[model samples]
Each structure stands twice: as C-alpha cells, then as structure tokens.
Target: MKDLPADARPREKLLARGAAALSDTELLALLLRTGTAGRGVLQMAHELLAAPVDGGFGGISGLLHAGAEDLKRIKGMGGSSKRAQLVAVMELARRAIGQQLKEREVFSSPGAVKQYLQLHLAAKPHEVFAVLFLDAQNRLIAMEELFRGTLTQTSVYPREVVQRALQREAASVVLAHNHPSGTVQPSRADEALTQTLKAALALVDVRVLDHVIVAQGNALSMAEKGLI
Candidate 1:
C-alpha cells in the first residue's frame, strides 16, 4: 500500500523473492528505514560508507574516538542513529579485543579468533590491526586495536604492542588483522610483521600467541602452521 513505509515495504518483497530481489542499496536502506527532512537514513549510510578509509568499516575503530557531536553532523543521523552506529562500532572493537585474550590455552584455537574477527572486520573496505592482551590464564584481560589504515599503509609498531603488554601486565598476546579482499592467506608482510613482533616481545618476556588473518568467511593462523 502507498501508506506502508519503505522498511515494511521491503519485507513483503523479501518474502516474495527470497531476499535475492533486493539490491545492495535496498539492503542498506532496510538497515536505516527512517530519514530526516532533507536526507534519508539510507542516503546517510551510503555517504558514510563512501568515505575514504582503510577497510571502511574495517578502520572504523576510529569511531571510538568520535565524539557525540561529531556523529550528529551527518544529515539524517540524529542522536539515536548516531548512538546505534557508535554502539555497533564499539562492540565490534570490544569483541575483537576479547578474541585476542582468549588465546592463553582455550584461546589457542585460531578458529575462535577468526570467527570473532570475521564478524566485524572482514566486511570492511580497509584494514584493521588488532591485538589481544591476555593474563597468564588467558581469560581475556583486554583487546585493543593498534592501527587502522588503507589496505597498503598501516603503521603497526611492535614496540607499541610491547609497551601495551607491559602496561596491561599481560603474560602473552595474540595479533590479528582483517583482509577486505576476502582472502585468508597471509602475505609476506603479514608474516614478516608477526615475526618482528614475536622477536620484540621475547625480550620483555611476553609471549606472542599467534597472528591471525581474517577474511570474510575464513581465517589463517601463524601458530597452527608453526610460523610463530
């Protein structure tokens, strides 16, 4: 009916077409059904996605650094929408952090880390560098992101990771990153980076559990293959 809104309107079509009837924009529009006087929620989401950043949502760890006032600047995003997006971003970061800490013993399974990272980082258009700081028991003390950048230029410093480990008093750590390309294969740089960090942490007596590569539906681990 003409009176039915866009979101409700889409549901009927979805059920009729088995979800294949929707366009990417339509799917995104469904996520944000409401719009403002000048801009619709879908339009705002599109604009946000279009912004140039590493891994797009991949690099959105910076969203944690975004003040409430900053999010309100979007045309159709008021307090609620802004908060929703912010909450989603923050939770993604929190989960990534959690996966890292889980690496002590039970956390030794890279599959677990991959499962967590894939949910948040794989769909991104850029890259995310994340670290998990764990206590001796590997109970998940904290998970932190070390860098966010384009697919090519992320400034991941091993010293910073070492410093954070010392600060958290973590006995060990796990490092992970996402590949927006949907490939779980580790690049030479990825291998080199993990090796570099492993050696650096050795001096301070902290352990490098594993370096995980997360793709859309898959993951690769350095430790499982004896690369670490």
Candidate 2:
C-alpha cells in the first residue's frame, strides 16, 4: 500500500475528493490503517470482503454483525486496535442512521422507515422481531426489538406485542424483522405472525400500518404487497 503515490493514498484521496469519491474498499482500507507483513492494507481490505464470514460471503453486512473476536479472524485484523476500529465504524453507522430517523417524519416517508429498519435489523446474525410504535398522527413513539430467536426462526407472541403497544399508547405500528439469509421475501410464518399481531393490537385500537422484511440492504413492505 505504501508503494502507491501520495496522491493515490486512501487518506489523500478522501481529503482531496471527499468520502463520496472513495469506493467501499477504499473506505475500508482507511479503517484498516495497516496490513500484515505479507499484505498491503488495500489488499487486506479486499480479502476481508472476499472471505466468507457470514451467509457464505464476507460483505459489509457480515462485517456489521461481526464482533471484535470475529474481526480478529481476518488475516490483517488480528490486532485488537484494528478489531475495535472496525466495530466502532459499524456502531457509528448504526447510530448515524438512528439519528437520521429521529430527525425525519418517519410515517410520512416510507422510504425513510425502510432505511431505518434496514439499518437496524438487516445484517443481524439471528432473527429479531421489532415494532415501531407511532402516534395517531403517525409520528414515531418508540422502536423496540421484542423477540429474538435462532437464525431461522423467531417465536413472536402477539400478546406481548399488544401489551407493548398499549403501554406506549401507540395509535399505529410498523412491524419488522430480518432474514439473516439475505432474502426480503416474507415467509408464510411472517405473514401469519403479522396477522396474529394485527388482530391482537386491533383489540386495543392500534392500527397495523406495515410489516417490513429486512434483508442485506433491501426491505419489503407487506402493505405495499397487499399482504398486510
């Protein structure tokens, strides 16, 4: 990596042309900082992405779910500092997305809701069922991950979901969960759970707005598909 001209350096390119000018690998190389004795930082970054860390591919989504120990498994990422840096970068990204959601009118923008859910639930290594509680006007009341399960399935209790909605005094809700397998297609089980929760929440006068299935970087809205 050091063999590259100064103008071609990741940091220099970022400073000269800004972050938008860098590719995903270039941004990752900046985080890696240094490489192993036999590898350059840029090469190491590429290897990290190429290596199968999760779902048979070491993509950015896999990295987002990787802990420090998981990151250390990468060839040039054995150092604790490098592991921490990578973990910190992912945390910053998650929080930045959260901050953006808080600033926007969530219900008015379905795309924003999808973006927030994707950032929050997508890339998780296991199943997570979450709810976005909204006021009568559709403003966000709260967001909660209510149930967690194995990689393939989660047992969502409609009673618990309804209780939380009542507690929040939410007038509406958005249901969401992630398929770690990187497919946003709603399963039969997903549809069943949504219907169950919808009926349960309706008893308390809470409307079910949508059920979104989040995958890698994509999301599918049940409402849009006429499934909800």
Pick by lDDT: which candidate is best?
A: 2
What's the lDDT for candidate 2? Answer: 0.81
Q: Estimate each model's TM-score.
A: 0.57, 0.86
Backbone clashes in model 1: 8
Output the TM-score of candidate 1: 0.57
Error of 1 at 28 (Å): 13
Q: What lDDT tens digits, residue by residue, belong to model 2 across residues 1-228?
A: 678998889899999999999877889999888887878888888877764743223667666777787776667676788888888988887777665555666656888788778767887778888999887777777799998985222467788888899899898999999988888998787888788888888888999999999988689999999999
For each candidate in the order shown, give its overall lDDT on alpha carbons.
0.68, 0.81
Model 1 per-residue lDDT tens digits across residues 122-170: 6555788888777888666766777887533237887788899999998
Candidate 2 TM-score, C-alpha based: 0.86
